[model samples]
Target: MNRYERTRVLVGGDPGVAQAIAAEIEEICEVEVLDAPREELVMVKVRESARNSLFYLGEALMCSCRVRIADAMGFGYVLGSKRNAAYNLALIDAAFSSGEEFERMPKWEERIEKEAKRQRDKRAKNRALIERTRVDFSTMDGDA
Candidate 1:
């Protein structure tokens, strides 16, 4: 993925990963918050598996904020009611989008990739655990 994509993935990813990025960036760069974190309701949509149709799952509460670093503007939107986390995301986004050179940024890319992998692994493990306990009753129809 490109730099901006990577940055977004890191910023929009798991809270721990986002926090790490925000914490590290704060030590090296200056950030100015353009918008305070605020919550809003947004419609959540889903595709019906049985039919090619879309439906609204319901309104999701989301947090959003904007930040500025140098001349670049960055924005962040996330699911749930985390004000501090939303602001952190905005700051991290702005720092990366600033286009200014930072020596530690390359290292950050590696960290982001690692964090993503970790989350994927965790999710896979959880899925496997859930599937294992899901009994397939159809397989026992003949016995009954």
Candidate 2:
């Protein structure tokens, strides 16, 4: 299997800090950062086996970003900023530890089944509608 996979990391807030973190991660893993703070929290995307080690490293990186922001711009300034840092952290934690609870195969299968049923129902309804709308214009012309 390939050892490395392409990934992108979006870091919000200060450009310098975001760039620094991006550079650090780029050394060992592929990374890209978009230094826009319009939304709350930063988003990092990576494909490293989806294993514990990679998860922990991601978590650690988030923590580092938090600390770096806090140190540079005071605690209260960034305490409740627009970023979804907290959510990202929690998501990483869940993804790492949720085990069978977070497995998405069942959900995906259910979604597919529901969509298929919907399509079948729609087709049946359309067929009925078309049949009802069919014209007996030929017979009408002969009688007229």
Candidate 3:
């Protein structure tokens, strides 16, 4: 059985509308709701078992307004078969959930840049050492 699980609910409207639907779902299952006003959509995620219920709730939300269920990918290895699904969901979630003033973590970016620089430096050093050790066979005498 797959360990990791996720359920996505897509609703249409503003934050207030999304929050209401999310609150209702939260009463029955653990969920995180993200509102994207620019896209006119709200995303909700829950556990695998709660997917059906979330879908039903999504339908109800749609009836009240215009909304579309973007996508749904159930339980599986998050990094394997479901990588793309997981990634897309995360991107949407992050974009919507992050506050208006939210900024990317500069420290994390700096760390990655530093690591890449170190790797490049190590590779250059290795290449230099190999070149320095390369022997010119023509310059050596057959016998001492």
Candidate 4:
């Protein structure tokens, strides 16, 4: 993934990642908040598989914030209720948007990939456990 992709995943996925990035940026440049963080119910969209028509899936809880540094405006929208983490994500976005160099992402790439694998493994394990409990009700009495 490129810088923006890496930033998106790191910021959106883990609050710790955002905080880590923010701390690194804070050491060098001043981060200014343009808009305070707030939580709201945001509409999520889904598409029809056949016709590709879009519709609202439902409202998802979101925390978002906007920040600025120099002349660049940065925005962060993340799932869940971590208001502070959202602000940190926005701050990291602002730092990158302002054309500052950050060297943390290389380290983050490894960490993020590891975390992703770990999550995938955990999910697969859970799925297998759930699958083992599955039984076909129609076949329980040998009814075809």
Counting clashing residue pairs in each candidate, in order, gives: 0, 6, 0, 0
Model 3, position 121: C-alpha lDDT score: 82
Write model 3 residue lDDT over 48-120, tens digit each, in one string.
5854443322311111111122332121112223233333343333333333222333332343345446556
Model 1 scores a TM of 0.74
Q: How would you order the candidates by lDDT, starting with the best? A: 1, 4, 3, 2
User: With candidate 1 superimposed using the best TM-score fit, by how many Å does residue 125's alpha carbon deviate from the native?
Assistant: 2.1
| The 10-residue segment with the lowest total lDDT in model 3 | 59-68
TM-score for each model? 0.74, 0.26, 0.28, 0.67
List RMSD in Å for every model shown.
3.2, 19.1, 19.0, 3.9
Q: Extract clashing residue pairs from model 3.
A: none
Cα lDDT listed for each candidate: 0.80, 0.33, 0.34, 0.74
- Tens digits of per-residue lDDT, candidate 1, 42-98, equal 999999999989999999999999988889887878788988788877876787788
> How much does candidate 3 score in TM-score?
0.28
Q: After superposition, how far is residue 59 of candidate 1 from its true place, in Å?
A: 1.9
In angstroms, the error of model 4 at 105 is: 7.2
Per residue, candidate 4 scores C-alpha lDDT tens digits across 59-131 of: 9998889988788787877788878887877776777667655566466457657655666688899999999
Q: Rank order by TM-score, top first? A: 1, 4, 3, 2
The number of the candidate with the highest lDDT is: 1
Residue 76 lDDT in model 1?
78
When 1 and 2 are scored with lDDT, the better candidate is 1
Clashes of 3: 0
